[model samples]
Target: MKLVLEILTGVLFVVEVGEGCTVAGLKDAIAAQEELPRDRIIFVLEGDPGRTIRRGEDGVPIVELGFRHGSHVYLFLEPEEDNGDDP
Candidate 1:
C-alpha cells in the first residue's frame, strides 16, 4: 500500500509499505526516508478532531486506520520538552 505522508514543514512523501505494517514500522520507515529520528515523528490522522496515533500501540495495522493506497496522513514533529533549566 502506498501512503502519503505530509510533514509539518509542508513536505509530502509517498512511501510504499505493506498493508499490515504497524504504526511503529511506518514511523521507522518515515524516519528512514526523511532521515529523521523515529522518536521525533508523530502521526496524526487528518480530519475533524485529528488524533495522534501513538507509536506504542501494537497490533493495529495501517489499513485499519483507514489508510489505503494514496491515503494522506499528517506528520508532526514531537516538540522538545522544557527541562526547566532557565532561571
Candidate 2:
C-alpha cells in the first residue's frame, strides 16, 4: 500500500509498501527520506497521539500524510536539537 505523510511545519512524503506499514515504519521512512534525526520528529493525528494510529494493525485506517483532507489527520513537525545543550 502507498501512504502519504504530512508534517505541520515541515515536509511531507509518501511511503509505498507492498505488504503493510505501521506508524514506526512511517517514521522510519520519513527519517530515511530527509536524513533527519528521529528523536526530533513528532507525529500525531486529529490532536490525539499519532503513535496510536501508527500502532494499529493491518486494515486499520491511516492518515495519508501529503493529502488535502479535512480535520481527520494532523501531523506536526519540529526540528530536533542540533547540538548538545550548553552546561
Write model 1 residue lDDT over 1-87, tens digit each, in one string: 888888877998898888789887888888788888788777887767666786566457877776678877988877877899989
Collision count of model 2? 3
On lDDT, the leading prediction is 1
Of the candidates shown, which would achieve the greatest TM-score relative to the real structure? 1
Error of 2 at 13 (Å): 2.6
Residue 74 lDDT (model 1): 88
- Candidate 1 local lDDT, residue 11: 90
Q: After superposition, how far is residue 8 of candidate 1 from its true place, in Å?
A: 1.7
The per-prediction CA RMSD against the true structure, in angstroms, equals: 2.2, 6.4
